[model samples]
Each structure stands twice: as C-alpha cells, then as structure tokens.
Target: MDVLSLIGIILAFVAILGGNYLEGGHVGALLNGPAALIVLGGTLAAAFVQAPMSVFKRALSIISWIFFPPKVDLIGGINRVIGWSMTARKEGLLGLEAVADSEPDPYARKGLQLLVDGAEPEAIRSILEVDLYTQEGRDISAAKVFESMGGYAPTIGIIGAVMGLIHVMGNLADPSMLGSGIAVAFVATIYGVAFANLLLLPIANKLKAVVLRQSRYREMVLEGILSIAEGENPRSIELKLQGFMG
Candidate 1:
C-alpha cells in the first residue's frame, strides 16, 4: 500500500474541513447534498461523454493504483536479465526456453520466447517495441480519461453554481432563504474545484506515473532479451541494464 497516498487523502480532508471550522463556519454549511449531486453527477456525465468505453473502463480498473500501485523492482529486473544472459551463454539461446516458460511477466516472457526462437536482435526489438509502446499508449490514454474529468469538473461546478443561483433567484421573494440559498449555490463551485484538484487530477497523474514505470521496466526487459539474442556478455548486460535504475 502507498502510505503517502493514504496520508495525502487524510490531509486533504482535514485541511478543507479544518479550515472551514477555523473560519467560524460549521460542517453543515459544506454538506449541501444538492450541490454535491450537481457537481459529481454532472462531472461524471461529462466524463462519460468524452471518454470511450474501453478507456473509461481502463481508468476505473487502474484507479486503485493510487493506494496499491503495481510493483516495479529495478534491481530485481537487472538481476533477472543477468541470469538470462548467463543461461544463454552456457546453454546457448535455445536454453532460454525453460526460462521463457516460467517467466511471470507476459511482456518479459514474450521477449524471452523471441530469444529462445533465435530471432534476430532487430526483429526482437521491432516486435517488443511495438508491444511496449502499444501497452504504454493504451495505459496513457486511460490516465488521460481521469485528466479529462479533471478539466471538466471545474466547468461543471460552475454550471452547478449557475443552476443553484437560478434556484436562489426564483426564491428572491423569500428574503429569509436568500442567505442559505446563495451559500448552497456556491458550494457546487467549491465541490468542483476541490474534487478536481484533490482527487481526479491527482489520480490521473499517479496512474500515469505507474504506467510509465511499468513501461520502463518492460523496456529494460526488452533490452536484456535483445542483448542475449545478440550474444552479449552477462557483465556487459548487467552494466547496461543498471542504467535504467537511475
């Protein structure tokens, strides 16, 4: 779990609520259900319209990465690559057949299979780069779904604010209701701005970071597999792969 992400969420709530309290405002003032509904519902509706079904589904699936990110072990990857290099050196390229079979990562496994089949280095690079970039593009598109939501949220909030003000305008004859009505109208704006900055945008950026790290890991794997295909020394392969760590 990402302890920092947990802390950030808790702190965001505390900061907003605590600041409201310190301003001589009560919690109930910010608990306008209509405002929340307008902001959240409208924002989601806008997001649904803008993102394709696949991208939207991908966004939903990866959102949990904010707290429980996919692991990317750079040191471990380098070590694994070195091991593959050694195996290939001693038993030849065909020796990687067993390693390919047992490899856990589908990306790495595909690269290993290519090596085991005695693919030319350029052929392996071409195949793996396509796989790498295709997956990266898909994931980046998913992250952009959340980013699109973030961009839409503030404007949707403004719309909510306008709708609320229209309601306030309709009730101008009731002077006693004016204060609360106006407050409710502005709450939508607060919800919109806060939701976008605190949650949606942050989620998108974090998911992007996770995707990029995964891509880098795959790139490292691809490089290792290519090196083995070209019959490079394990020590040289280790040094080359270590550059990815930095």
Candidate 2:
C-alpha cells in the first residue's frame, strides 16, 4: 500500500536534486545542519507546543500511515456483511454469536454484539455513529498538527536564512569568502520551503487521506449493521453495501 507513496517521495527528491546536480549545483551546499535543525527540529518542537501531548503523540503515530495505510477491503467487507445478514435472517440473533466472536475490528465487533443483544436499529446506529465521529475527530486533530508544522517550517527557514546572513555580514572583510557566504545564507530558505512542501505538507495531506478512507469504511460498516438490524434481506443488504465499493 505504501510502496507507491514511498516511490513518489523519492521521485520528487530525485527530480529536484538530479536536476540541480545536472546544472552544476553542488548537493553538499544544501546540507547545512543548522538550516535543517531550524526547519525540521523547530517544526517538531512547535508541534509539541501547539498540540496536547496525547494529540501530538497520535500525530507522530499516524506519520507512518503516509507510507503504510490500513487496507480497506470494501468488497470483502460487503460479502461478510451479506453472510451475517443471511445468518441473522435464517437462524435469528443467536446465530451471530460465532461470527461476532470471530470479528476482529472493534467497530464491527461492537455492531455484531448489539445485534445479538437485540438492540433496536436506532440505538445501534446512534452508538456506532458516535464512536465513528469521535474517532474521526481525533484523527483530524492529529492531521492538523502536521498542517500546523507545515505552516511554521517556511517562516522558521527564513529565520535561519536571516541568522546566516547576519554571520555573512560579519565576514564582509574577506572578499574571497563573500560568494560562499551568500550561498550558505540562502540555503536556509531552501531548506524551509523544500521541507514544508516536499515532506511536512504532503505528510499531513496523506494522513488526512488515510483518515478519510477509514471514515468511509466505518460508515459502510455502520450502514451494514443498520441494514441487518432493520431485517433487510441479504440480497438487498448486498446491493446497498456495494455502493461503498466506489
């Protein structure tokens, strides 16, 4: 799942770096440790300051989702729901005990439990929807931390550039060193923009995309549970659930 995401990021770096190298730009000039520290380190520090500890932790955790997102098997999910619906119709609530016990996803497990407990469709829908929305809210919050970091990185880079230029100004007595000094001073600006666009902003967007996919899956599961509780036939439930595939 994350293979393509990894390739895209690598390709982006290669395109820019390779192009610069071909044009006689030394890659080592962009390797200023202080510039990276200001842009990336300060961004993380700002994230820690801006978000609650828990939210920040969750944001850190979801960073990997940019590379390896959760798999959503919509077709398989629908087929499972259809099977459950058939069992519920033919063998009644008790028939779902085995399936419910075997279910792995907590949301789906909870739904099956409610079904076997004879929960009214409305009550089941209310509970599951609340859980779904609450989870989505947390995921959104996590994504926002990265978005905020992206906002900070560019400005932080500018600060780094200004500081570098201040040092450069102090060395004006050395004419031979002036050109290198000016180049080093501007690397901070490049660091800030590149980190923000190529990594931070993209990571935030990817995390949001993962959250969106998860939300859709949860909504589909909730719909399936409600359809089953409403005593809809397996064929009808299958038809309704198939819409989630898209």
lDDT of each: 0.90, 0.87
Stretches of candidate 2 above 4 Å error? 176-181
User: Model 2, 54: alpha-carbon shift in Å?
Assistant: 0.5
- Tens-place lDDT per residue, model 1, 115-231, is 888788999999999999999999999999889889888888898888878878998999887876687678989999999999889889999999999999999998888888888
Candidate 1 C-alpha error for residue 97, in Å: 0.7
Model 2: lDDT of residue 135: 97
RMSD of each: 1.0, 1.6
TM-score, candidate 2, is 0.94
lDDT per residue (tens digit) for residues 1-246 in model 2: 688889989998998899889999978876877677777788778888899989988998888898778897788888888889999999997899999999999999999999999999999999999999999999999999989988998898888788878777888998776766566568878888888888888888888988988998889999999998889999988889888778
Clashing pairs for model 2 are none
Per-residue error (Å), model 2, residue 78 = 0.3
